[model samples]
Target: MHEPAHARVPAQPLIPAQQKVLRHSVRGQVLDALRAALVDGDLAPGEIYSGPALGERFGVSATPVREAMQQLALEGAVECLPNRGFRVLTRTARELAELAEVRALLEVPVMLRLARTVPVSAFESLRPAAAATAGAAAAGDLPRYADADRSFHGQVLALAGNDQLVQVAEELHRRAQWPLPGAARIRRADLIADAAEHSALLEALIARDLPVVESLVREHFAGNPA
Candidate 1:
């Protein structure tokens, strides 16, 4: 006897590549959402959040949420608790200063070097990212501002042709942007000033003004909190 149509037409399982792509997509979404929450102060530092709870909040399954949290843990943004959940790590003022110092150490020289050698078009290309930061700052969108800020800096460093330097500098940038418990929230004015500095720095780079570029980069790392 022949099987029924529904039984005969069995669903095709996803191939390994497709499955991997899907998993990575979901993981990336969850990670972005989690980072946005962290930046916007929606996820309080020192507060523990369970994967299932955050999954429900993000409209995904616990698997992706846990994966995102694990990545965050590796980034020093959170800590994994045995049988509990992930806690947003509270950073001290000293820790933030140190991160800023390290980032400046890694990036300032690159910016100075790129200023002398990289073409004007390369720096000009980053204008949009700089503008995005300004817009986000004006709108008080902390998450967008943070992402744009990182993108601008990363683009600047990428011109140096050192992928490792870009990665390390961006990691430090991300760590520096994390919220500190009991600390005053970064004001909109501060964000705007920081964003404006990006434009100034871009202009200096495009003009190949090494002295101005170095000063702007150093001041930026010293003053920018997010």
Candidate 2:
């Protein structure tokens, strides 16, 4: 006897209250949801966010919402109004281009430096992250794909042996996540193509080829074509 069509499908993960709290951390969940909302243009730039209103949307209370907003303000993703509330921050094309340029500036040199020094062990450490990124892309999970991308780049920065650069990369990477919503729509082919680039970078690093690694770094930071 054949199983029902729906029965053949994978079961969804259960979201128990304890698991929900663990996964979301209350504040991080609120922050990420609000950030996604802002980046997706659901909350237009300069639009005031009411804590109670936002809490209602998330089925929580204002405390978490306010905490999220304050975090966003620190990240420059939102602005706080004294008598009003929080407003989404907008970015222009030129501003985004500049941000990418900055990433290139910090990243390319570090990758080049790492390429010269990366041991076989360090290069091997990146294989899991690369595989995970490819898996996320294959699954068409944009957020997970992006997170894996961050992880891959972060491992590279950490391998460079510069704590300050690693910190800088983390901060910049967080800001870069803002542009991803529109960029993802524009470069729909990228998530797949970008996965391949990670492979090239990994191979170049393993080979200890500084020039090839630098070139690959430039290609990776150049952004994806729509």
Candidate 3:
């Protein structure tokens, strides 16, 4: 029961506070598909994607495409222009290194504290994220892998019971995942190794091996080699 390709589903711009992560809506579906395209390199970095063209590709009107692009803009994934469409933003090696440094400084200690404070059983509920990351890596699906990675880390920080800390971690994490200039060069094996880190970290957390967990967390961020 889907709408026709020519259907013109209208879209409305959302205010900052009202903005929710796109999910379960027509625009949200478009948003997910578009993100996959970006991650798969179907949409090259530094390239511009016109709203109408993208809409046609997704079999909708331009509204949802534009709406999704706007959301991507907020993620620091793209820059929207007045007369032109959105331009994919590129990052430098130094910038990516700095992002990792900031996350190491901000999140490593928080994860360690949470690991120590929360019971091992508290983290058992989050196993699905690790599973999802593994699945995505097996399929070489970068977009799904990124989403699951974000969810896994975000959940770990949320266990610390600090909304503000989670917010900061999420922002920095999203920026760290940006399609840097070297992103296209990453291989499936690299992503699989990345996924393995999550699994290893979770095993340490569940074992209540605080020292090992702390070391794993620090090592993971030391080089987001993915």
- Clash totals for all candidate models: 0, 0, 0
- Better model by lDDT: candidate 2 vs candidate 3: 3
> Can you write out model 2's per-residue Cα lDDT over 197-224, one digit (the tens) per residue?
8888999989888889988887776663
- For candidate 3, the 10 contiguous residues with the lowest summed lDDT are 3-12
Top candidate when judged by lDDT against the true structure: 1
lDDT digits (tens) for residues 1-226 of candidate 1: 3211121111232123234457788888778878887876777777788777676565567788899999999999989987677888888889988988898888888888999899888888899989999999999888889999999899888888889988988889999998778777789999999999999999999888989998998899888969
Residue runs of model 3 more than 4 Å from their true location after superposition: 1-24, 182-185
Candidate 1 backbone collisions, by pair: none
Name the candidate that leads on TM-score.
Answer: 1
Residue 24, candidate 1: how far off, in angstroms? Answer: 2.1
TM-scores, one per candidate: 0.88, 0.81, 0.81
| Candidate 2, superposed: residue stretches over 4 Å from native | 1-24, 38-46, 180-187, 224-226
Instruction: Give model 2 RMSD, 1 decimal.
Output: 8.8
State the displacement of the C-alpha of residue 8, model 2, in Å, after optimal TM-score superposition.
32
